[model samples]
Target: MSMKRPNVFRGYAALICAALLAPGSPAAAFDAPARIEQNLSLNAQCGLRAFVHNLNGGLASARVIPLVSGSSAQTQAAGGASYFNGATSNIFSAVTAANLQANCGLADVTNLVQQGAAGAYAAAASISLTFEATRTSNGDRYAYRAEISGAAATTVTVSQTLVNAAPTVTLGPPSGPNSSGDYTVVATLSENSSDFTAASLTLTNATATMSGSGSSYTIVLTPVTDGAVNASVQKGAFTDSGGLGNWFASNTLSFSNTVEKTQKVIAQFMQTRANQLISSQPDLTGFLSGSDTGALNMTVTEGGGAFGFASAPDKGNGVWARLSGSWSHESDRKTSYAFGVIGSHVNLSPDLLVGGMIEFDFLGQKEGATRVDGNGWLIGPYFVARSPAHPLFFEGRFLYGQTKNDISPLGTYSDSFETQRLLTQFKVTGEIAQGRTTWMPSLQLSYTTDTQRAYTDGLGNFIPEQGFELTQAELGLDVRHEVLLPRSRGRLELTGGLSFVGSSAKGSGYASLVVPEYAGGRGKVKAGANYTLPNGAVLVMDVYNDGIGAAGYESYGAQFGFNLMF
Candidate 1:
């Protein structure tokens, strides 16, 4: 289905948007005071009449003052006032007239109802400002100089909440040493007023030294080459940055001579334990029917950097093989591309933890077919949060894609068109320990489109074109725990998961057979075991059986995979 249409098939279009907009979503919302929409002419004149207003009770100054002249006036007025005191800032006839006559280069100030604000407001306010501006006597756009001079009658009433704030920061290591084997520094933060929120920080001649994260700074100092080093700190004032102050920890860097190396690789193989079926399951034949999917990777460390590459091969159904390549420089890594005949995956990132990814593939057409082919691109943004010491973990992914295809034989081929697709998942995992065993519980959601399209061979040599959409609303509960191992070098884990799949499919151009089957909703259960090899390599295997099958018989399969990182 096109993005322009509603989701009658799966009805997930709205659901996805709502999910993305949910709390703790990847990106932050826009918090600008006004979404200004006007020509530069009016925007320029707006500078003189700007004022601050406190809508959330008169506890603070809510806006920045913009004036052309009288820096003295501003300092004596808004500057001296406590920013948090709520006030109704009005800059109308007085300031407007004065600014026009003094700095606007206007010959006269009349019909001026200028009013503007810069702080957060309960609701937007409008001022009917109409002032007579002076132009060059030549009647042509010449720069003689037009200045509007006068003291604008401006009155600002501000109310602010007196919030008690304290200086808080993470302590970081020090850099320089003081006399008597001591080092000293200071941190200063300005008291913020009600007008705005601060979002930035800066340090002078000081370097930040911290290993972890949070609202703290580490102050580490290297001992003097001939002696020892001591350190002390003092607090300073906080000044405004270009915009809102950032509300997060800060890290600073000094000279460093540290180089690190890292590498990661994942490989999986689907083992066919029953009659290697083909006629019934088409999409599953390529990867699922294969006995093994293998991959290997390695990296070298140098000047604070590293790189690696790997390839996983699987031969099933009419599909062939896939290979992946990646590289890393410190914390940033990128995957150039992954190419394969049936299914190809590409990841461009420093680590698997998260970044951007795109996977493309050509499926459907038989191996020796002369023409027919189905190809599409799946691209999306992803993020993952994990910690070795934390019991709770989270992962999220979002993907939007479009697909197009061509028919092989003239009469047998279908028409061609574009189809859009979306995929998103959010999961949270918690780890529980029971003696020698640890269990991981997780919650997740999977969403997809439920519509598709295709054309027939009727329209004048016009090959039949078609598309289809499918969706699975799955709710799952899973547990994974570490098992007793023989040695400290090797590890083992046991896992089990249950899921309920609700599916739907629809289309116009393609036949019903091509459409995905929702069939009857069913419960699926799976249990698996994983073992760690000697050289930091991990091996995993799992078996799953779903009671109800959409195409034919109940579906059951086992998968094995391994991962190596250094």
Candidate 2:
């Protein structure tokens, strides 16, 4: 491709020829083969442009030539200056092996002219370059000052940006192995987060309260539905200190919301089981205590539901000794087996009886991730007295004991503790007779205390069961009707009764769970029968409910036993 000469180039050539032929201004400027490439490239970026020139197939005697910057016509250089000279940014750097100064130090040129952008795209950059060619014949120099320019770039493009990595968080497991209806979940931040709280939880089937701060936070979950529980913190639900991350949601905390009481709740369960078995021991000596002077009785018993007992005692001076055994199960599936012996006495004159009993029990319980096994022995005294004038009977009993227990959690951690217990009970009753029926009314009060040594569990948690107390009261009545057997050889007595039992209590809980506070009452009904033979043989069968049982449930069962007296 070849470039067509512009009219400016032709006219400038003609003017140069006229100057050469003229007189006074001769040698003002000359013409030779000065090689120039026009509009080579618009290389202006962040303020630098470039130009190149040569003359007569060799390094040109080129220089950056200064012409009148703002002058229109006069005030310009003498004769040889070109029309394009006012495009200087006034800042320049020439690069070459040797730079040249021409026009008597008025201009300078090296191999290259470097120009740059003007004030924000004001105009393009131009440098007046005088390229001189040497004439082969006369060694005369011919030069021309022509403007060189570049297309100044108007804008710059960049690929760098400002952003931060997002933070992440995880919702830990429902706080520990929650066996109770209540539990908690901890949301832990991968990095510290300022806005993470219970409010950030996107809860399903539960309500919560929040605690802790920064990287670790806890939300105690109270299930609102008795179904499946689902909980999570949505992405962006919380933010970091730099207010950057929330790009990921915390892990989901999910479980069944149904009641699965364990740990301290199981303690209460097992405690109530122990209390029932200890307190509800049938008084096999009741019959002997009511006997006349010199009365002798022997008893045998079996098939006690919850706690069935067997006893046999030979009576002497109102004194008797007997042995009994019982086994019981709680609503929480905890079980207790016990055996005991009682030595009793009766004084018929004023109708008073005194006795003492010793017993030992083995217990096994499991709930959630905890299991406990233990054995204990207890000894206590009891009394029964009737005021001749008042026609009322009074009874009382107290027992104290300590247990050696082994505790295992999740089949992993293990430990042991000694637990002490004291049980006290008192009752009063009166009787009214009409025809073949007798009606008895009674009121009883009992209190129990358990001092379980504070211990560290397998996972380094403290069980502060130091001492838990429970008190209960019961008011009941029984009506018995006698039916004589044929030939007057035996008699059958049937009895029915109703009772109201109430209790109040408070204690420490297990691990992070609180020992629950208790204050409530329930109604109970019972029925029983006794068969008496002429030779002092008797049979007993009874079924009753007294509003107490494993982990807080309705407690009812039956007892079957027999006796012989002379």
RMSD of each: 37.9, 18.9
lDDT of 1 by residue, 1-566 (tens): 59636555456866788878887411101122222221112122323222323323322222223343434222112222222223334432234345434433444344433233234233323222234433212111111211111112223322212122233233345433322222333332333322221212343332334232233233434333322223332222221232223233334433211100000000000001001111011111112222234434332223121222233322222222333322223233221222232323222222224444555533332222223334556566555554546655555656666656444332233445444656666666565667756554556555554123333332332223333444445666777677666557788878888877765544333223223243456778999887777776767677789865445647666665556633
Q: After superposition, how far is residue 287 of candidate 1 from its true place, in Å?
A: 26
Each model's lDDT comes to 0.37, 0.55
Best by lDDT: 2
**Pairs that clash in candidate 2:** 49-115, 64-108, 167-245, 269-551, 304-308, 508-515, 509-514, 509-515
- For residue 492, model 2's alpha carbon misses the true position, in angstroms, by 1.8
Give model 1's TM-score versus the native structure: 0.33
Off by over 4 Å in 1: 1-355, 364-372, 383-394, 409-418, 450-467, 487-489, 509-519, 548-551, 560-562
Off by over 4 Å in 2: 1-182, 185-266, 282-322, 328-334, 344-357, 366-371, 412-414, 457-462, 511-515, 533-566
- Writing each residue's lDDT as its tens digit, candidate 2 over 117-212 gives 232222333434333332222222334333444333211111111233456778777753353557877777777877777788888888888889
